[model samples]
Target: MDVLTDLLQRSRARGAAFSHSTAHGAWGVRFPVGAQLAIHGILGGEAFAWTDDAGTSRHVLAGDIVLVRGSAEHFMAHSPGAETVSFLGHPSVGPPGGAQRMVFGEGPGSSTTFFCGAYTFVGDLCAGLLAGLPELTVVRPRSGSSLRATLDVFAGELLDDAPGQQALLDSLLDVVLVQALREQLAADVHAAPAWFRAMDDPTVGSALRAVHAEPARNWTVADLAAEASVSRAVLARRFTALLGVAPLAYVTDWRMALAREQLREGATSLAAIARSLGYASEFSFAAAFKRHHRMPPGRWRTASRRQAAGLASV
Candidate 1:
C-alpha cells in the first residue's frame, strides 16, 4: 500500500454529517469545534472561511475547496466577519439522508451554493496523515483536475434524492478527502510531514513502499537496501536523514501503532497481533511494547479502553 492509503486505512477515518446549503449576501455560519476534520466546497458564488482565532479569512471563489483539520471552531460566510449562527441542528441542516436548504438575506442578491462535510477519525494513528496540516488549507479547483471533476459530480448528486444517495455521497466524500490531501500536501511540501515528503525520494521511497507492502516480514537493513537497489550503508544514511529515524526503528514504531489500535478495539488475541506484526511470540511483543510505552500491553490496553469509555460517556 502507498503511504496515504495505508495511513487512511489504519487510522479508520470515516465521513460524517454532510449538508448542502446556499447563502445569499451578508451571511455567516459557525461550525462548532467537534469533528476532527471538515471540508467545504464552493459550487457557485464565493465565500470567506477562517477559524475563530485566525482574525483573518481566506476568500474562496467558485470551484474551490477548504479543509480544516483538528477540533477548531470555524466559520464560512459570504463576507468576512459577518454575523453568524450555529450550524448544528439548524432547521435546514438535518441528519444524514435529509434535505438541507438554508437561506439568508431578504433581498435578491448574489447567492453562494456550497456543500459541507465532516470526518471522524478512530484514533491518534490518524495523526500520521493529519498532524502536519495547518488549521485551514484551501485549494482552488484547477481546470481538468480530477478534484474539480469529482466536485461537479458531487454537486449533481446532492440535488438528487435517489436510492443509495447517502452511500454514494459517503463514497464521494472519501474520494474528495484523499484528493484534497494529495493536492494540498503536494502543494506545500515544506510543511508536510517527513514521512510524506520522503515518499518522493527514489531510494527512500522505494524502501518505504516495500516496508508498508509487507510490514510483517522480517526486514534487515540489507533487505530494505536491496529492495531500493542500494547499499545498506547508503539506505540507512538516507532513510535516517530523511525521516529522522533508522529504517528498522520506523518499522517498529509503525508496528506498535497497529498493535495499539488492535488492543484498543479489544479484539484479536495477543498472539495473533504479535504474529501479524512480525513478533516472535506474545512475550516478546509484550516486552517491546512495555519498553516503548512504559506499561505492559495488557495493562495499557485496559487503561486506554477505560479512558475511551469515559470520554464517550461525556
Candidate 2:
C-alpha cells in the first residue's frame, strides 16, 4: 500500500482518545514516550503546549491540531506560569478536578476542550513515513480550507450528544488525521521525503493508487508502468527515485501489510488468506511472513492478538 494508506490502517488499529475539561487551576501537563499519540482540539478558551526541545516552548491556540508524535514529554497549561504536574498513574498528568479521561469521548463542560489519542505504527513503510516527521507536529488549518471546516465539524459533533456519537467521533478522528497529512504535504515543497515526494508526483501517485487499490493482484513492473502511462524503464527509475523502492517491491510490501492486518483480525485461515493474497499456498505465505516478521503467520497472529489485548486493557 501507499504510505498514507498504511499509516491510516496502523492508526486505526492502535488509536484511542479521551475528552474532558481542563480544570481552571490546572497547570502544566507532561506526556512521556509510549504514552500514545495525543491530539488536542480546543473547543473554547486556550492553552499552550510546551516542550523541552532546545529548552524552548512552542505555543498553540484554539483550532490547532497539536500532535505529540513521539509522546515526548510536554506540558499544557492555562499559562506559562502555571505549575507543571506529572501524569497520575503514569508518567504524564492531566488537568485537575479528576476529569474523566475518555478515549475518544465527548466533554461535558465549556472548558478548553481536547481530544487525546495514540497510534502505534507497524511495518517498514509506516516507520519510514513517520521518521520524516517532526517529534511534535502542530497543524494549523489554513483559512477557508476544508481542514478547518472538518475540524469545526468535529468540534461540533463532540459537543453534540447524538446517537452513535462514538463511532462518528472515530470517523472524524480519521478525517482529522488525513487532513493533517494533506496539509503537511501541501506545505512542504522542498526536497521532501520519499513518501511525500512520491505522492506529489502524478506518475508515482497513480502508481501508488493502483497498488493500494489492488495489492493482491499479480503485479509486475510492466503492469505498474502501463497504469502510469509511462515506459517501463521510465516508470522504474521514477518510482525508485520517488519511493526509494522498485515498483514490484513496493507492491510486495503492501501485500504483506494487508496480510498482517488480516492475520491480526483472524478474518480467515492462513490458507484462505494466502489464496486471497495470490500466494501459491499456505506454506508460501508462511515463509514470506516469517521472512518479513521473523515468525510464521500463526505465531505472529497470536502475538499480535495478545499485544492488542494488552493495549485494550490499558
Candidate 3:
C-alpha cells in the first residue's frame, strides 16, 4: 500500500453520522467540535463556513467541498456572521433511505442545500497524516472530475431510500473524502508535509513505500537503497534531505508509532509487540522504546491509558 492508504488504514479512519440539510433565507447551524475531520459539500446554493476559534471563512458555492480538521467548533450559514443554533442530533427527516433533509428558516428566500459528514480517527499516525493540512481546505470541483461525480452520486443517494442506503452513503462518503484529500494535497504540494511530498520523488518515494509496506523488516540503508536501485550514500542523502531523517531513523520512528498504538490498545503482549516490530526480544524493544520516548514501554502504556481514561470520563 502507498503511504497515504497505509496511514488511513492503520489509523482506523471511519465515518461517523451524516446528514443532508437545507435552509432558506437567513439560517445558520453551529457544529460541535469533536470529529477529527468534518466534510461539508454544497450540493446546491451557497454558504459561508468558518471555525469559531479561527477567523478563516470562505464563501462556498455549489460544487464546492470544504474539509475542516482539528477540534474546533465550526459553522455554516447563509452569511458568515449569521446567528446559529446548535445542530443537535442532526436528525434526519425519515427512516433509513428516507428523506434525509433537515430544514431551517422556512421563510421564502434563496435556498442552500448541503451535506455534512464527520469522520473519527484513532492513533497518532493519523495526526502525522493530517499535520500536512491547514485548518480549513476548500476545493472547487472541475466539471467532469471524479470528485464531482462522487458528489453527484452522494447527493442522489440521499434522495433515494434504497435497500442499503446507510451502507451506500457511508461508502460513498469515504470515496468523496479520498478524492478531496488527493486533490488538495496535489494542488498544494508545498503545504503538504515533506514526507508526503517526498512520495513524489522517484528515489526517496520508492524507499518510503518499501518502509511503509514492511516496517517490521530489518532495514539497513543499503536494503532501502537497493529498493530504489541506488547506492547507499545516494539513498541516504536523498532520504534524509527530503524527510529530515535518515532512512533507518524513519523506520524506527514508524515502528514506534505502531508500538504506541498497540500499547494503547492494551491487548498485545510486550513480546508479541517486539516481535511484530522486528525487535529481537521484549527487552530490546523496551530499551529502544525508552530511548525514543524517555520512558519504559510498560510505564508509557499505563500513562497513556490513564490519560485516555481521564479524557473519556470528562
Which candidate ranks first by lDDT, i.e. highest?
3
lDDT of 1 by residue, 1-314 (tens): 67888888877889853688888767889988878898888989988899987889999998888999856899998778888888887777434564466655445679998988888888788785777888898988566889999999998988888877778888898998889888888888998889889999999999999988998899999999999999999999999999999999999888888899999889888999999999999999999999889999999989998999899899
Q: Tens digits of per-residue lDDT for model 2 on 65-165?
A: 77766636766766664576555443233333222343211234334656665566553335555665666667788888787888788777665665666
lDDT of each: 0.86, 0.68, 0.87
**Which whole-number lDDT from 0 to 100 does residue 217 have in model 3?**
95
- Which runs of model 3 end up more than 4 angstroms from their true locations? 89-91, 97-99
Pick by lDDT: 2 or 3, better one? 3
Model 1 lDDT, full chain set: 0.86
* Overall local distance difference test of candidate 2: 0.68
Using all chains and alpha carbons, the TM-scores for the candidates as numbered come to 0.95, 0.75, 0.95
- Cα lDDT for residue 149, candidate 2: 86
Sort by lDDT, best first. Answer: 3, 1, 2
True-structure RMSD, every candidate: 1.8, 5.9, 1.7
